[model samples]
Target: MNGLKGLYLEDLVVGQSASYGKTVTETDIVMFAGMSGDTNPVHLNQDYAETTMFEGRIAHGMLSAGFISTVLGTRLPGPGTIYLSQSLQFKAPVRIGDTVTAKVEVREIIAAKKRAILETNCYVGDRCVIAGEAVVMVPSRA
Candidate 1:
């Protein structure tokens, strides 16, 4: 690890993983809507959401996906890592009060580019709510 508390490129290995979790809340939903300007009724209006396929207000998919950022930025390759790209698939609704667990595992590393590809996923209990992949650039020790 570096002094910044992040793994240097040389320190990472395929299959290494880390995770973090948070419970979605009304405050979180409201605040996210404000910050992201994603006030979609399905996420904020219970009545409208009730008519949707999910049948009730659901937390923003991006909010659950943010948990993946938390894992990559604060754990695993950590603080100094720079995100190159991410692709996510929303698998299920994340309801208020559901605890979402985000996990990221290193899948590949390119030494010349000092980059890593990771498998990212978020779960509510045993049910997967989000699945994705991320590519990040890690600082080189040399």
Candidate 2:
């Protein structure tokens, strides 16, 4: 496939990878809370969060995880990729202003099924904030 249409199944290699980065912000957390209907105090109420293990308000875990989706949907597999499954492990807190970089690498390809298993990860500087695996159905040239 051409760049505009994303990579076709045949175009993928096991080690191919891509990444996208974004800085977490107060507006991002607030908007995510509203859009996801998860007004958890840990993510919204600073005082309340101060009592938690984080000791301060932290951006939602899913917000960081969502960066993985951004990398998949717009970067590696690009625009036509269909996400089939994902497994995630949240490891650290993401505070407002932290720049999160989401990375995805093709780990395995099942040509018969037109599917690819990718290793997905999000990092803040050198610390991994989220780690996961994703299965996606990629377009083909046939």
Candidate 3:
């Protein structure tokens, strides 16, 4: 994957798409928990998770959403992208073994001011675990 470093403000198209992903791992869950201070028992203590609605632990919703931001920062809008806002709904829990693929597609691009509307989704297998829209600012190279 290319590093997002030179995306100025004029390279975005309204129909472009970007995608990237990896398998979820317990280490990732633990690390994210430590970094974000979101160590809910369901995400850390397996014994406690065994009592939850899922009958096991589930990854944080924001963790899946992070994948979406990664795709945008490293692919579509690239490095110079600024996130304005985003809204997404979680449709399913992401287990530790689930391989999540995050994708973002441009729905509208405001070329005059270098802003864009993007539709984003995070999927685990055939299930759409999360989906939503995001507003971003892309800086032009020129």
Candidate 4:
């Protein structure tokens, strides 16, 4: 999926939003756990997970955060955007096969600084699984 040329700082508008979705698969959970060194039993061992409140294995929280990155870096300001910082809160367990949709909306922009602040969130059907904000420096049209 190719994205169009990115929007420059001057082109952003408050309240604008973009979204993308992905199904959390077992492979995705395993790979993310391996790559991130998050070997927690709740994410890697279903038997262990079943003993806990979630009832089964859950995907890494950061894995759901990556979906938010996809929307910010590919759909909004896009390609040339520079990610500055992000703050996130994990609200719910994302089980394998659950479809997650990430959404980002322009919250504020500092034009002189070429920066933007956005509200970021991920949802599973009607429930919000993650909520956060991101600061990014968007490229100039020049």
- Write one digit per residue (lDDT tens) for candidate 2, span 6-93: 8889999999999999999999999999999999999999999999999999999999999999888888898899999999999999
lDDT of 4 by residue, 28-142 (tens): 9989988999999999997999999999889999999999889877998788788999999999989999999999999999988999999999999989999999999998876
Lowest lDDT 10-residue stretch of candidate 4: 1-10
Give all candidates' CA lDDT scores. Answer: 0.94, 0.94, 0.87, 0.91
User: Clash pairs of candidate 2?
Assistant: none
lDDT of 1: 0.94
Score candidate 2 by TM-score against the native: 0.97
Score candidate 3 by TM-score against the native.
0.91
Worst 10 residues of 1 by lDDT: 1-10
Report the number of the highest-TM-score candidate: 2
List, in order, the clash count of every candidate structure: 0, 0, 6, 0
Error of 4 at 127 (Å): 0.5
Identify the runs in model 3 with alpha carbons over 4 angstroms from their true place.
1-9
RMSD of every candidate to native, in Å, equals 1.2, 1.1, 1.8, 1.7
Error of 1 at 139 (Å): 0.8
Q: Write one digit per residue (lDDT tens) for candidate 3, span 54-82.
A: 89999999998999999778787777788
Please write out the lDDT profile of model 1 over residues 1-142, one tens digit for every residue: 5547799899998999999999999999999999999999999999999999999999999999999999888888998989999999999999999999999999999999999999999999999989999999998889
